[model samples]
Target: MKNLDYAYLGPPGTFSEQAISAYCSKYGGKTHACDSIRDIVETIVKDEVDLGLLPLENSLEGSVNLSLDLLYKHSELKLYREIVLPIAHYLLAAPGVKKEDIKKIYSHPQAIAQSGDYINRHLSEAKIVYTDSTAAAAAEALKHDDRAVIGSIRLADIYQLDVLAENLQGDLPNATRFVLAAKADKDFSDKNHLGNNAESQFKTSIICAPEVNRAGVLHEMLGEFAKKEIDLSRIESRPTRQRLGEYLFYIDLMGSSEDPDLIEALNEVEAMSGYFRLLGSYPKTVIK
Candidate 1:
């Protein structure tokens, strides 16, 4: 394997950054930390780096819509790898500051959502302040004794903040799914066939928009998969933003795109869909 240049969402200490760190620990790479997921996606789309990593979904916080939207819009970028990182949230405050001394709480929105129960019960009086990243929240916390942040334990030492409380996510075993993306410009005759192998477990993601605004179209679309005996792992809807009721469907098929059955099924579905996109066909990484 080559030494890849990776981009991630961060100012360091974010789960996205941590995910890339874990991924590259065995195979070293330089990481470019972007301020947002869109930046990371765009960087990959533009081929500014060898790869990009993004937090796609969370066990507690749900799907990251920005990631989905960017992927849908950038059909040239392929999701080649996935990393499921075990995430744990912690509460940090300035040195010598106790939890009761904190009057305001700052963190990324997903961090806030994941710690909802703990915040409601323990820091109900604290004002909730959201930041772009958990590391940014920790950066903000360093300036105020009355402020606290909910983030990873890795952030405490980075900003010289004290761990006001450990595992503040209500003892839940939280995890985030991150995807590795790269440009899909290689031809099939090229070596590795764009990173494909017979032994790899694969997942193909696609975006579907119905051609006509009619009833039972979604059911009919799904029937195409069922009739072909394709197993869908996930299905999510996203607003196309053209109208109030109009939406786009995202689905993950539980097999490789190279499979003849999948190719046949997709060919039929594509004809009926107003717009359809094959985001990627890549190997699935299962983390222990």
Candidate 2:
């Protein structure tokens, strides 16, 4: 493959960078940092970048709303793969700044939310300063010895900060799901698979909007997959945006889109739903 360009949400030292590091190791891509998640996605959509490493959901914080909203609205991008990185927040302090010495906590809102219980219990006195990204928070920690940041462990090396306390998340085993997206293929249809890696054990994602919007329409659409013994791994609906109460159901099913059982279920669902979109298929990996 050509040397690919992978854009991520970062300044540096964020979890998205770490996830893309794992990806670039496999795919031989050069990484680029964008100011916002929207920048990353729009660049990928416009072919300014080859791939976008985007955080989709967190084990503790539910969905990353900005990422999800972007994906939902931009149906022209294909989800190339899914990366599940175990999120371990570390409190990085400046030199001589002990746990008790810290008075200000710099963190992304998501990081703050994820570590809320621990903060309330242990370091309740510290003032919270939310930044655009965790790496940005890491930047803040570097300036003040009395301040600390909750960010990636790698930030300690990048910013030369000290790890005051590790494993500060409310849940010790917290993780975030990231998706790699690229400019979508124009001609992809029912017969074709999204990628060669998608030929085996994989997951296919689709967005569905029911035709009639009547009671039980959603239930019946799901029943199509349930009856086929095709397990639905995830099902979440986002607003369709055309009208109030209108919504689109985004689903992840445990098979390739080309799989016979999956094909049958989707066929039934497509007929029942007014709108259906195949958001590509990809293999899933949980990064340790």
Candidate 3:
């Protein structure tokens, strides 16, 4: 078997690292750590690595905007597979500290957002500090006495922080969906078999900007999918970053891009929209 090199977001002990390790373990491959998701994607694009794993969305936090923005801006990479790992957040602190001693909570913005209700109820007087990653926040908490960090339990162990609490996020079935991406020509069909079966389910994503003053433009876009009975899975709008009121629409549908109905929908969308891009067709992540 050929050896594979994989890149994931890390200083280590991140949920991304855990997900990457789980995927690589089945294939006996080594995983490399990257500073950011963009770096991971760029590593694959430059042939510095064989694959890249990146978080796409979380069940509690909705879409990861940076990942979507990066995907929208980078056209050289392709989505090869996806994995959904159950999320279990922990509150970690230095060994001598107790849960009641914590005066502030720190974690990645997504983590903080996911655990909002819990934080509001139990740590109402605590301040929230957003860090780059859960692991990073935990590392910082290790050097402070009054701070607690929300992150993976594995991170607390790795950093030698005590677990003040477990499963801090109230979402019982919380999970994060990650994408496996590679350069345009890399074959992923084999790994597809090794990954989560949920990764094998078909899904297509596209981005578009509708023309202004075109009455029923949104309706027309939906009509293409509805006319063919194609189910729309998600639709989100993000600012174009060009100007106020100018926005781009990201759409996910339940079918492969190559499916006849999907192809026809894209064709019609291309004719009706000002600009459009097909993100990729890949398997959907199964939420547990």
Candidate 4:
């Protein structure tokens, strides 16, 4: 397959950059930096790149709602691949900066949230500051003697900062799941898909909204999958924005779209749903 271009959340040293770098190293691609998730989506929708990689969810933070919202708003985009990157946040600050001297903690909200326990225990007195990205937080920390950043270790080297603490995240198995999104019109060769082995499993994402908000309707809709024994990995609801209380459901199921049982279940769900969309099916990468 020919090398492709990818857009990822950036300003360097972010986990998003790390995720796409690892993927491109194996799959063959060039990486471009986008300032935000919306920027990544916009580039793909505009055909500015071959794919846009953005964080979909974090084990600690649950899900990146902006990613879900963007996927829902843009019908032309599809998830072509997903990668789970292990997270290890370090307390980084400029040389000569002491932990006791720190008066503020800076990081992207997800990173800050993931390291909440550590922050509370070690730097409880410090004020929390949110940045667009972890790398951006590192940039901000570089300028302030009393500020420290919680981010990837790479930030230390990139910003010439010292690592004051390592593995600061509260969770043992911290990770962020990222997905490569592409325009539906793009033709992806087999090489673009990973886990091609015959025994490989796949994951499918879909969006559905009930035709009516009757009682037990959500349960009834999910029953179709339950009856078929199709495993659902996740289900989240986002406001429809068309109504006061109505919502659109985003679901991730553990099977390929081509599976007979999944297809049957999906058809049933669609009939009962006023709005339904098959986001895409992609190879499932098991994270060790």
User: Which stretches in model 2 have alpha-carbon errors above 4 Å?
Assistant: 59-63, 186-200
Off by over 4 Å in 1: 59-63, 171-173, 186-200, 241-245, 286-288
Q: What tens digits encode model 2's per-residue C-alpha lDDT throughout 66-160?
A: 77678878878888778789889888988778999889999888789888888998899999999878888888888887899998888898888
Name the 10 consecutive residues with the lowest summed lDDT in model 2.
187-196
* Per-residue alpha-carbon lDDT of candidate 1 for residues 66-182, written as tens digits (9 for 90 to 100): 888778777787777767787789899889999889999999887898899999989999999998788989999989889999998778867888887777776665778877888
Candidate number of the best lDDT: 4
lDDT of 4 by residue, 131-187 (tens): 878888998999989999998887898899999999987655577888788998777
lDDT, candidates in the order shown: 0.79, 0.80, 0.79, 0.84
On a 0 to 1 TM-score scale, where does candidate 1 land against the true structure?
Answer: 0.83
Clashing pairs in 3: none
Give residue 154's error in model 2 in angstroms: 1.7
lDDT against true structure, model 3: 0.79
2 or 4, which is superior by lDDT? 4
What local lDDT does model 4 show for residue 32? 96
TM values, all candidates:
0.83, 0.90, 0.82, 0.89
Query: CA RMSD for every model?
Result: 3.6, 3.5, 3.3, 2.7
Sorting all predicted structures by TM-score, with the top scorer first, yields 2, 4, 1, 3
* Local distance difference test, candidate 2: 0.80
